[model samples]
Target: MSATAEQPPFRPRTVLLIVGVAVIAFAGFLLLIAFAPPFQGGHDARGHALSTSGNGYAGLVELTDAIGSHSLIVRDTDLLGSSALLIVTPEYDSDGAQLARLLAARAGHPTLIVLPKWLTRPMPDNREWSLKVNTIWPEGAIAALDKIAPKLAVDQTPFRKTVIPPQPAAIPRLARAAIGGQREQQRLVGMGFTPMLLDRDGRVVMGKLIGRPVYVLADPDLLNNQGLADPWTARQGWQVIDDLSTTNEIAFDLTMNGFAKQADKSPLRLIFQPPFLPVTLCIVLAALLAGLHGAVRFGAPIAAGRAIAMGKRTLVDNAAMLFRAARREHRVGAAYAALTRDLTAQATHAPARLSGEALDHYLDRAGRNAGDPPYATLAWRAEAAEDRDQLLGAARALYRWRRNRTR
Candidate 1:
């Protein structure tokens, strides 16, 4: 019985599937990292006081509280009672500010209004007791504060005390620092409030209204954290509060004109609000589609076989064709040289070479000596021949010479 032949299986579809899947998976991974939101660290001024235990107003919180409390009292009723309104403004919108404002409002004291720094543009003309403070810590304001309040000034000559490093996202660094006397002084002056300026050396340089109903604490740090624990700071804060509370209505202006100047322009009204959501959605959809298509189409296995096709002509065939083409173009000298080199290579496989005198001596040795033909007689007449007839004669002579040599 004849043996049955085994046939190889075809697997083009399987191979394509594997490649497509790999491409899709790589794209999905890249998209996931690109569209993910960044994680925020730390809390804001409002949250810092409630979330953590300690002197909550150690930094900007103290300043914000002071301004916010003052504003609330001025806006609502007289400060004669403990139930005064406190308004807190945020450098930006944040949960901490919201919580602080809500807590202050519920206390039956002052209603805390949380305003972001960006809202400064449409500020009302008569917001008597409104206080606006940045949510983020403003370090630059702290440096400026050192120059405004004599009681709040510290030894910043070495410049070491002036520099405050960035804090965790939860910690309001810069805004807190700005509550220092200098910032408060500037803010008061801008808002039509009486502010006293002090030099860095702790000398009061301006404004002295000791008995005025309105008492402003430029540096809130003097009343927060370690400052709160200090005898002088606490006494001073109490004195200022008591003096201001004498009036039927006490106003805390937490809003600083400096902050207004630095307030970032609203992006909502800008030419192009960032298209984060739309961009993210498009990227996610593209990734999902690619993955699904790859999974569905590339589930098969690939067959193992040679994918490249083999050519019929080798190096020798190529050289022969090149020589033939050159001869057809009337390049008889180049064609003849190529033919001679090929014949010589084949003949010299024996350790001896056929060249010059040796070639002639070998012819004689083979007893086939003949008179040498004129070298010029072998010249390709095609180069000088202008007519096709002369070219044909030259080609014929070349052919006859090749034929006789073979014989």
Candidate 2:
């Protein structure tokens, strides 16, 4: 066989298949990392979860627990049926319609709406507060309250600065509040609201609706992580909690803070969660097994023989067998006669003197007998032989004539 025909096996396709599978698996891994939740412990920002750091109110939430009061961070809106105080700390993006719906759900229940005042930044560590200043008007908070209570009026003007100490007040239905810190000077005009805690200038910092159980606190720091840090400010938080029924279960609304409970019914979620994890593991294992089976080689390959290696005799036998299999024995009759003629010329060296039909006729006359058919007739019969028996008899007669003429 030629060197080119005997080349070594080079299956680049197998290597390409392995690489393609690896790339797909890597892409799947990257997708999982991007979409899956991180493995860590910490509450989210935006005042949604019960966290003590930054803008979170985890201190007050935990303080309520310490004082033997049952408090929960309400993620699901369906749990708003309690008659207890529902504290809603609505951020800027809180939906007014949803807030209205929540208040409507707790129609008879007492709800405390703490207005967002300060625009504070989280520390570099993200566990402490930094740069805090009050806004001139909490328009979003006011708009939400306006949707629920149109009669309520909220002061848009910034509170006047007070150098004086906090004022002690004898407010009925509520415990004495310590007006410490800058809260003593925070001015808020509540036209229809009953003034509960007044600032140094007599502007209501805390108020209640005339007929409704809705209470409004102008400052969020009174009960947030920053407000709860001071002893005097902490008292105000407790008093506010006390005024709102301590016996009833208290639930802080986290829905406004972008913490909503979602019902996950997707197949991927099911596979990731509880009892189905094992099934998912099994499926993954099965896929890995299939990939390995497809990628790996089982054994060494067996070498095959060259295509054109047989001799002339073996080629003729194979050709005859093929003609017989195809029922085309007549097709080989002319080939057999030509082969006999060539053999006779090589043996006698008579092809130079006589050629074509003349040579054929000369040989036929020399080999003719009384009973046997003429050589020309036999040659013609071989050329036109149709059936297997006729073809075989004609081939024999031509061979016999060649042998006798050659001798």
Candidate 3:
């Protein structure tokens, strides 16, 4: 066997390479997600306590606890009087704010209005003196407060600011009116005191006079952890409470609890029905059958074919046959003669033998025309001779013309 015959067969490595790359890519994707950060729970700004519950009740509970513990004293009872009360109002759906306000607005105290900032409409009564507390204070209210209480320390801390805004002057008046109404009604009902329920829009929809004094705090941010630290806010809250001294002081825990019970009382349970068993079984059986069919009816593997070699002799063979046919028909003389003339002119010996004018010129040129000796002899013999003689003479003349030039 030849050395080349012993060479090894070709092997394709593309499939293996692709599978290896796919496996590596999938592994990298899984690794990327594995190290990502875990989700965060809710936190209280005031007490720095974290709770799994998402409701922002931590701040409210902290504020209520602080007040209940008597850590912060309420001041300014002289001005608010025995009937005066502190009111707390929450902004938007701030349950924390609401709970805090409720805690501060307890019985016999100046009603503190803890108004949330998200009230859609304005209160119809438009009662002034209510102090509105919210995570965000309206720009107009803030601007107005800057004039009345410039020394008031607005909680500008990021967390504090997010929960509360600058206090407005109109807040105190509105809050007081609401508390006063509630107190007046409570005294009449002998239920201790009435608390004014103000709608989202500062309007006093009900409870104008419970005969008890009232102080409205429209903003709830004042009681937040951030607000508690502020001297002005603490002082303001104290002053509202102190003004209501003389009568019993009630600390209403108005803040909503973060862990408030959910209303969904139904217990979760799974029910299994026998009716769907047939359908489920049918689907599973269909899937299994399809998988089995795919496995069993799989097509046979096909092998690739080798590249084809192009034919060369097909072109050369056709050209040779055409030239032979033309010669047998007696048309080869002119062509042969023309070719001889060119060869003779380029030849050293044939140039002299073929030289001269007219017939000599023709011979010298080495080309055979009808008048030339070789071509004329061939043509006459071709017309007179019968059968193969004419063809033989034509072939001879053609050979002689070419041979003479070569000589």
Candidate 4:
């Protein structure tokens, strides 16, 4: 046998099935990636209302859900305008300019700004887990407080951690604030801050801005995931919100906490956004249907005809083309003369051994006997054509001789 490589080990059918399954899985993964941001359900590990981590306030949100209190996590900056009490947890690196604008807009509404304390990094092993290395610098926390209360500063060393009821009217609820047992002993300490709730040593734990309706919570541990571990602390946090909330929908702002989703004009991003999402789904479905149709299609392949055909007619046409290409037009007349000469000799029953001149003389006598032109003369005319007109004349004379002999 001739030396040749063997075919691949895998079957075509199995390969096709694997490819189809892989394509489907990839499409599912893309869909998951597109919808993950909006439908995350507040499972992040950052120190925000959307996080379920120790430093986060997601527990407070869960507490509201359990008590039948209406609350929502706000991802859009536009939602901050609602009259409800917005619990905003601003990160250390949050935009101060944007924070000022947001606080300014809520002049008529109730706003509570919670300052961040712990600085943590996400665990590489678990996405939902995080490790609080240490506390954020007092200056960094103060900068976040500076947006509305630039005069105030964040202080961890309070003379006391418990609230001191200085204002009889505000202390009724402030005194009952379950902000005790905080992980980081931090509070707002400065002059311009109107002390709504203060420590025994006069540190502002929860205070209001001078002229604005915005409130500041210096320590977030009371409402954070760690603080709300028990039922009592969770209820205290809920009570604080109930006392503050003016509107039916309580909103916790996530926009300032690095969860803001801006409009992306990239083709991949656009397809995952509104309006185009349906188009993307349709295109995927169409492709799947087309693939299915191709896979299940039935029929044996029809054999194709050969490029070069075989037959007397095909042979004649090819010879004609060759003669035309070679500029041997006179050769056509010579071939016709030889064919007619043989046919006439056979018709006259002439001997096969006869020479060319003898054959022509015998056919000429037979042609004269039949009341036709002499065979020699007809043959000479047929073999003498040099151009198109001459060739036509030769073909005509030869045809007549053959017809006369047949008759």
- Model 4 regions more than 4 Å off: 1-10, 66-68, 104-107, 121-130, 143-149, 158-179, 230-239, 258-267, 272-407
Best by lDDT: 4
Measured on C-alpha atoms, candidate 4 has an lDDT of: 0.74
Model 3: residues >4 Å from true position, as ranges?
A: 1-89, 94-111, 118-215, 242-259, 262-407
Tens digit of lDDT per residue, candidate 4, span 56-151? 887777777777778887777667778888998988887787789888766579998888888888777776766888888888886766656678
Window of ten residues with lowest summed lDDT in model 1: 114-123
Q: Which lDDT values do the candidates have, in the order given?
A: 0.37, 0.68, 0.38, 0.74
**Tens-place lDDT digits, model 1, residues 1-407:** 33444433546577667767986897666544443222211222222222111223323334435554332312222221344433232233333433333343334443322222111221255322122343223333223232223233222212334322332343211222332232432221222222343333322222322332222333334444434555555555444444334333333322221112112224321212255556656876898788668657665678676564346656556766785666553545545533543453344342355665455444333323334232234443545554546756665654554344444
Off by over 4 Å in 2: 1-45, 127-137, 150-153, 156-180, 183-194, 209-212, 246-248, 263-407
Model 3 residue 203 CA deviation (Å) reads 16
Work out candidate 3's RMSD over C-alphas: 22.0
Residues 1-407 of candidate 2 have per-residue lDDT tens digits of 99988875666687778777996898588547533533222254445335555456878788888888888777677887677788888765567788888888886788888776555555566544444544535465466676766766555443333322344567532223334354322334545677676644455667887777778887666787777888877876787779777465678887676555532225655676669879877987898788778868789867898776689988988887887799998777887888887777777666577888887776566555534466567778988887889999898888777878766
Error of 4 at 257 (Å): 3.2
Q: Residue 50's C-alpha lDDT in candidate 1? A: 24
Whole-model lDDT, candidate 3? 0.38
Model 3: per-residue Cα lDDT over 1-407, one tens digit each: 99888865543356546655886796566444432212223232211123212111234344545555322222222222233233333333444333333433344444543333221222335321122233343432223223222332222112122322333444332333222122111111112223233323333222322343333333343343334455554555444445443433333322231321221111211111246546655875797677567646578767666464346775656565785666554444455445544555555344445442433355535553433365445445545544445656765765566566455
Best of the candidates, TM-score: 4
